[model samples]
Target: MEFNNNIPIYIQVIEKIKQEIVTGKLKPGEKMPSSRDYGNNLGINFNTVARVYKEMEMEELLFTRRGLGTFVTESEDRIGQLRYEMAKKQIENFIFNMKQIGYTKKDMIKFIETENYLEGDE
Candidate 1:
């Protein structure tokens, strides 16, 4: 995972994990990599990976089974909530950026309706 100097690395990791969960890329109840392996894979410190897991568990986005490993939360409702929150955040960011460029709410709505987004499909 590439690091963004402006933001804390742990935050970036948490966001990516949340996105994966919301998008179904990381299935509910799927066992996550052990902190050591995950740290190695991401070329980050083990403490960092541990911190990520701890924070996620605190958020109820993950759970750890004794003697087992951390897993993605299995609650569909929780995942749905996460999805909605992520989308809302993205929209808020978009609105802020558009306003910064002197675009109003009406302009944003108009652009959304008329823009050819096919060229930017990812």
Candidate 2:
């Protein structure tokens, strides 16, 4: 709920929801809080929460039932895909940062192997 001046609030909300889903805090098929309530809890505008929910629905991460509420998607495959995508993004960011610091692919590989090999040597 803390908004960063550097990033769009709606995007931050979307990420929070995705993290909850990936962490099992928000289980599949669980009903999400109504936009109004969530906004109040976060001290943000209802419209912003509505935008977050709508964008998530578009991503197939959530679905809304008529006269009911939005719920997390019930597809295990979708959840797995989300996890993979998130991990891939994290790895990509790590690689980019390492490259920015003048690390080559060879250096990264060597570092990984050295650190992991010693730990597993026993």
Candidate 3:
């Protein structure tokens, strides 16, 4: 995990884990690595990883089962909400860039519905 100097490392780690969760890379109820182990693997301080776990727990994204370790929360609604938020952000950025280059709303919609756009994406 490469840390960006401009952003807080803990926040970056949280975003990465959130992306993993929303993308289904980390399934609901999946067990996560122990803070110490994860810190060692990432070569960061264990306390920082512990902070991440605590923040996640506070957000109800993860739950700790005492000695059993922490596991991802089984929240389908949360996952759906996250997916929606991510898609909305991407679409907003795409629209902003398109409009900057003189594309109208209709043009954007037409392009999105056309085979040319699909082929360009491919």
Candidate 4:
């Protein structure tokens, strides 16, 4: 929950919530905390929490009940799509970095196949 100075706080908060949803830390149809409570918990403005919820709703990652509060989306297809979208962005970044370091597509594939990446290399 530490804020990155380089990134806007609301964007970081949005990313964190998205990650939680994608990872099942926030279950589908689970009620989200009230904006006031969430803002208090994060030490952010309530308006910021409201903005986050609004953006998420527009993205279909969340939906609000008439008076029951906001909940995570119950669509498995959307969740799967989110997972793929997140992974694809990561892979794009990895490839871009690798290319900048003089790596080829073949080299990247070979590195992946050879490295025991599943085991923590620490």
lDDT of 3 by residue, 1-122 (tens): 99999998889888889899998999999999999998998889999999999999998888999989999889999778877887899899999999999999999989888746677565
| Highest TM-score model number | 4
lDDT of the structure predicted as candidate 4: 0.93
**1-122: candidate 1 lDDT, tens digit per residue:** 88999999888889989989998999999999999999999998979988999999999999999899999999999999999998999999999999999999999988887886544775
Q: In candidate 4, where is summed lDDT lowest over 10 consecutive residues?
A: 113-122
Q: State each candidate's clash count.
A: 0, 0, 0, 0
Error of 2 at 91 (Å): 0.6
Q: What is the lDDT of candidate 1?
A: 0.93
Give the Å shift of residue 69 in candidate 1.
0.7
Error of 3 at 4 (Å): 1.5
- What's the distance in Å from true for residue 29, model 2? 0.2
TM-score of each candidate structure, all chains considered together? 0.92, 0.90, 0.79, 0.93
Error of 2 at 69 (Å): 0.5
